[model samples]
Target chain A: MQKQVEIIKANGEREFFDEGKLRASLLRAGAEDSQVEAVLRHISKELEDGMTTDHIYRHAFSVLKDVQNPRAIRRYSLRRALIDLGPTGFPFERFLAKLFASQGFEVKNDQILQGRCVPHEVDLVAYNENKLVMVESKFHNRMGEKSDVKVALYVKARFDDLSEQLFDYGKARPLDEGWLVTNTKFTENAIKFGVCAGLKMVGWNYPEKGSMRDLIEDSRLHPVTCLPSLTKEERELLLNNDMVLCSQILDSQSKLIELGIKREKVTTIAAEAEALCGR
Target chain B: MQKQVEIIKANGEREFFDEGKLRASLLRAGAEDSQVEAVLRHISKELEDGMTTDHIYRHAFSVLKDVQNPRAIRRYSLRRALIDLGPTGFPFERFLAKLFASQGFEVKNDQILQGRCVPHEVDLVAYNENKLVMVESKFHNRMGEKSDVKVALYVKARFDDLSEQLFDYGKARPLDEGWLVTNTKFTENAIKFGVCAGLKMVGWNYPEKGSMRDLIEDSRLHPVTCLPSLTKEERELLLNNDMVLCSQILDSQSKLIELGIKREKVTTIAAEAEALCGR
Candidate 1:
C-alpha cells in the first residue's frame, strides 16, 4: 500500500490522500510539461491548509478539462478515480479500441487527413490482412433520437474521405467496413439506420464486458504522463526544442515550395520515405 | 513523503516515476465536467500499457483547444498551468481582481452588459469608498512593437462603452480610474501612450511579484464554477424552479400590458421592488 500524502489548504486545514496512485495515473496519461509544474506550484502557493485528495483531483481535473487537449489526461485521471470508486461511461471508445487491438488488429489512433476544407481527424482506424475498419466511438450515458443519425453521418464522412484515394500505399483502396462503438445500447432506429448505411454497430454488450480487462491487457498501448512533475529548466528546454523542430520543418517546407516543387510530389516522396523507414 | 507508484508496461516491465505534470496542472486550473470525463475515459481505453504521460496530456489538451466558448477554457487551462508553475499575464486581470477584493474592495468579475449590441463582458470592475476602477489585463511573452497601439485600443473600447454621467448612489459619488496589467515589461512607447490615455500601467517587475497576489487576495473575487458540477437531478430541480419563476413574472407582465399599463410604469415598479429587496 502506498503511504498517503497531505495537502495544506489556505484555511489551515490538512487534507490527506493516497495520491501516489493518482500521480502515477497522471504520469501514465501524458502530462509531462512545464505548464503542469507551474500549476502544481500554484496549488502549493494557494494552499490555505486542509484539502482532500478528492478535492485536489476535482479541482485539478476541472482546471485541466478546459485545456486545449484534455482527452488523455482527463481519461487517465477519471480512470484513477473510477477504479477507486465506481466506473462510468468515461473511456468507452478507448476501451473498445484496446479490446479490438488486443485481438491482433493494427490500431491507428487519431488519423488526420487534409480534408476538402478543414482537416478531418478520425478517432481510430484499424487495419488487418483481411480488411480496413474505420471506427467512431461514443461514450454517452444515453443516446437520444438523433444519435444514430449522427453516427451515420460520421460513417459516411469517413467513407467519403477515404474514397478519395490520395495516398499511394499499395494501390489506394476504399474503406472495407465502418464501425460505430457506443457505451450505451443504440436506439432501435439507430441500429436500423446503421445497417441500412452498411455500417457495423458494436454496443458494449455483456459478453464483451466480461472480456474487457483481458482485452486491455492484451492490446499494447502506451501510457500517458502528466506535465507537473518537470522542473522549470526541463520545460524550457523541451519547449525550445519543439520550437526549433517546428521552425526547421517550416523552413524546409518553405524552401521546397520556393524551389517550385509541387506539393503533391513532395508529399509523395515524404510518405514513401516514411513508409520505408517504418515510421 | 508519498510513496512512488510504478506502472507496468506491455513488456512486463515497470516504468517508474514518470513526471508529466502539465495535464495535472491544467486539471488543477479547471476541467471538471462530465463531458471532460467522457473524453478522458475514451483516451484511457485506447491507451497502450507503456505510453508516457506527455503524449496523453498533449493529445487531450489539443482536443479541448478546439471547443468554442466565450470564457476560452483552453486559454484558462493554459494560464492555470503557467500560474501553477509561476504567474503569467493571461490570468492577471482575474488574479488582480481577487487580490483587490481581499483588500475590502467590492469587485465584480466578468460583468456582462446584455443591453449592449455585442454584450461587453468586462474582465474586472472594482469599487471602493474612494475609487471606481476598470482594469484590463494582457498576457504576452514579449512586448511587441505594436503593444502601445493595442493598449490604446483596449482603453478606447472601454472608455467608449462607459456612460459619461457619473453613477449616482444617492450621497455616494463615483471616482474613476483605469488600469492596464501586463506580464512583460511595457515598451517605452506603450507607457507613454498609457499616460496620454489617462490610464495607469502596471508591469510585473520581478521584485513586485507579491503585489499582484496581494491585489487578488484583497479583491476577494471568487473563481467561476461551471453548471455541470451539480448532478443532473439537482440541475433539473433548479432549472425547473427558475422556469416557473420566469413564467410567473412573464404572465404578470403580460396581464399588466393588456390592462392599459404603460411599459415605463411596470419597469419602475419592478426596479423599485428589486432595489428594496437588494436583488
Candidate 2:
C-alpha cells in the first residue's frame, strides 16, 4: 500500500496528490506515454507533505521543457501566458477582442455606450448580424485570485442597465447578450449568480465546454506570450504593438525586424511560432 | 491685486486657490476669527503655483496644531482620522456600525444573509421598528479616491437581491431600504445612478444636509484616532480592542490603564477626548 501525499492548491485548499490527474493532463497536452510516465515518476519522487500545487506545476513545466516538447510546453504555459498580459489588464482585453475577431465577429474595445440609467465603458463589444454581445474582462495578475460574486453582481447590473438601450452597431439594436470573461477561475457563487441572472460567463476552465481555453484552442489563437523562443521583453513589445497572436507574428515578420531582432533569429522564432500554432 | 495662484487638487484637477473657501472651512472647524486670519496670513505668505491641495492641508493642519486649540484640531482632523482607519477598511465598517448604533438603530456588523439568488456578506445592517437598512461601506484610504458608478451599481443589485428575502433579525422581516456609505466621495455618475435607482447613499461631504460628516458631528461619535494628544500606537491599541469612539474611552478608563499608560497621561488623554466629544 502506498501512502497518499497531501498537497496544497493555489487557493490554499489541501488535497491528496492525484497521479492519475497529472497523467491525464500530460496526455491531453499531447505528451507521449513514456514522457508522461517519466514526468509522473519525477513528480512522485519530489512530492512532500504540505507542498503547494504551484510548485508542482512549475516542476512539471520544467520537466516538459527539458524533454524539448515545444507544443506541449506551449499548451502547458497557456494559462500563465494569459496572466502575463496583465498588471493593467488592457492587453488581455485586446487579446480577447482579437480572439473574437478571428471567430468571424466584428469586435471593438473600450467602448463607452449609454445605458438606461448611466453610461458604461465596456471592455469588449462583439457583434454579428444575428447577435450583439457586451463583455467585461476580469483580469487577475496573481495566480490564485478568483473573481468573486460581487463582480458578477455588478456585471449583471451593468448588463441589465444596457439591456433596453439601443446602440448603433451598424444598426440600432439592444444588447442581445452580456458576458463576464476572466483569465482566471470564477468563484462558485459567482457562477451561481451568473447562471441565475442569465448573464453569460467565460472563465479559464469554467462551463466545461466553450471555456476561454476551449475558444483559444478551437481557433488556434495562442497569444504571442506563449512562444518559448521570444523573451519577456520581446513578447511585451509585440503586445504593445497590438500583435497578440502567434499567427500575427507569422503574418508580420517585419515587427520582429523593427524590434532589432537579427534576420536569422526572426526566422527561427517564426518557425517555432508556426509549429506551435500549427500554421 | 494679488495674482491668483493655480493649485493642483488631489484628483489632479487644477483650480485657483480660494482664500474664502479656506477661511470658511477653518471657521466651520470651530476656529476663532483671529485664528482664521492668522492661518490665512501664513498660507498667503507660503503659497506657490502648482502646489497640491494636500500640501495646503498639511500646512493648515500644522498651523492649527501650533494654535493649541484641541477641539478645533480634533474637528479639523476628523476627515483625515477616518482615512487613517483603513488599508483593510474593516475598521471603517466597524466605525460605521458604531455610528448607526448610536443613532437608536440596532446594528450588526458583517452579516451573511441569504439573497434571492445568492448570499451576501453585508457590511452593516441597521434596523428599528419603522425601517430596516442594509448598508455597504465603501472605504478608500487614499486621498481623493471616490466610489465610482460600478460600486453603486453592484450595491443596488445586492440590495435588490435581499429585498424580498425574509431574514430573522430579531423577527422575520424583509429589507426596507439599502444604503451606500463611504468615508470618501462618490463619483458624479455614481450619485446619478444611486438617485435613479433609489439607493440611498452617504459620503463624506455628499447630500449637503445629511452627509457622513453631518452624522458624525450630530452624534459626536468621533473615532479615537481623531485625538491629537494620543500617539498613533496608542490610538491603534484602543481601536484593536474594539473601542471605536472617543466616548468609549471615558466609560472604560481601565482599558487605557491596562495598556500600561501612566495615570497622568491617561487623565490628559481622556480630558482631550472629553473636550473633543463634549461628553
Candidate 3:
C-alpha cells in the first residue's frame, strides 16, 4: 500500500486522507462511478503532503467543471448554493423548512421554548401526527466555519431540556428527534457523537449516503438562491417573502411579475425554476 | 400637590412619586372612592423620604387583602400565581397566548425570528386578518426582579428586523404593535422607554388600570395555581397540561377528577373556577 497521507481541514485540524470518502462525495455530485474513481486516483497521486482539503476540493471542482454543464455544475455546488442563501442564514432555515414541508411535515420557524436550565431558542420545528423534530441551524456566513461536535452536543442538551415537556403538554409527544443542521460541513466528531446520540444531522456531506447535499438533490427542493436565472435582487425578493424553494416560484409563478420581474421574463423565471426543481 | 414625594425603588433608584397614579391603581383594583381616598390619605401621611417601593407595596397588599375575598386575594397575587404556574414560564406564555386567542387573534407561542442585528426569540405572536402583534413575555421567578428599560430597547430593535418582511410575505401585514408582558412589574424607565418607543407594555401593575393584573381579572383567566382549594400536586397537573385559565377548567370540569382531586371535590373545584372566570 502507498504510505498513508494526511490532509489538513478548513479549521486547521488534521486527519488521515480517505480516498473512499472523497470518491463518495464526487459521486454524490452526479459523477459516474468510473469518473469518480478516475478523478480520485488522479487527484490522489497529485496530492501534496499536508494539503488542505480546500485545495483538494478545488482541484476536483475544476476537473468536474470540464465534464459538467453549467446547470450540472450549479447543482453540484449545493454547498455553496445553501451558503449563498443568506448573509443571515434565516433564509437557509426557511429553505430547509420548505424541504420538510414538501415531505408532509408541518413546519414552524424560529420557535423559542423553555429548556431545563434556561430559555432556548430553536431555529425550526417540524412535525406531523406522529413525530416532532427540532432543528438547530448553525449558520456561519463563511462556508469554512463548520458545525462542530460542540454544536451537536449543545443541541442534544437543549433537546433534553424540552423532551419531558413534549409528553406532558398539549399534543406534544416526545420529539421524534432533534436535528442539527448546518450550511457548512460537520466535524468528524460531530458525526460520531450525533450518530451515537441518535440526534439526526444534515450538513454539506456528513453522512456518506444521505447527507445534506444528497437530500437536496433527491428532494429537488433547491433553495431559490441557487437558481442561475435569478438576480441578487430577485433572489432577495424571494428571501424577504420567506420563499425558499424554486418550486415555490413555480407554484406562485405569477408572483414573479408582482415582484417587479418583468411580465415577459416571468416565463423565463418559471421555466428556469421548473427545470431546477425538476418539475 | 404633596411636593412630589420621592420613593426609593427596589433597585435603589429614587424617582418622584405621583399620587394620582396610586389612586387610579386602587380604584382599578375594585376599591371604592371612599376607601381608596382613605387609604391614600392614610398611606400618604406616612410616606417617608426614600421608602422603598417594596415596603409601600406590602402596605398596600395588606390593606387591599382586607377588602378582597379569599378568591380575590388569590387572583390579586398575580406575581406569585405566575411563578407558581411554572417550573418554567411556558404556562404564563401560554396564558398570554390564550388571552389573545380569546380576543379573536390567532396565536403562536415562542416564535423564533430574525431581527436586524441578531436572531430574536419572541414569546408569542398573535394576529388576525387586519393586524399582527408580537408579544415578548418577561417572566421572573422573583417578584422584585422587574423587566427594565433595556428589555424594551432590545425588543424594539428585534421588531425592526422582521417588520419589513411582514409586508412582503404570506398574509403578513406589518405588526400592529409589539407588546412586552411580565408577571412582575416594569421599571419606571422601562415604561417610559416603551411608551416613547411606541412599544406597548403590560406588567403586574405598570399601566395601572388595564394592567396585567386587571387583564387577567377582566379576562377571567386566573392561573390554576391561584386556586387555594387545589393542592400543589393538582396545580402541577394543571400546569403540566397547559391549563392556566380557570375558564379552561370549567370547560373540562371532569379533569379535576382525572387529576386525582376527590370526586366530591370536583364540584368544589368547578364552582371556584366558574366563579373566578365568572362563567
True contacts kept of each: 0.00, 0.83, 0.00
lDDT at B278, model 2: 46
Candidate 2 lDDT by residue in tens digits, B39-118: 88888888999987756754764575567575555655898889878667888888998998888899999999898899
> In lDDT terms, which candidate is top?
2
Clashing pairs in 2: none
Which has the greatest TM-score? 2
Question: Residue A106 of model 1: what lDDT?
Answer: 76
Provide the TM-score for each candidate, comma-separated: 0.26, 0.76, 0.39
Candidate 3 has which clashing residue pairs, if any?
A: A110-B112
lDDT of 3 at A144: 78
Deviation (Å) of B57 in candidate 2: 27
Residue-wise lDDT of candidate 1 within A1-279, one digit each (tens)?
323456643234565543444444344334565544544544445434345443564454344334325545433433332132113332344445555665678776667654332244567777777777777766554333124443544455445545554532233555677777654456565555566556677653312443222232233221111123323343233333331111122235444344444553333222222211111
Q: Which number leads on DockQ?
A: 2
Model 3 chain B worst lDDT window (10 residues): B161-170
Candidate 3 local lDDT, B70-91, one digit each (tens):
3555555555778776667788
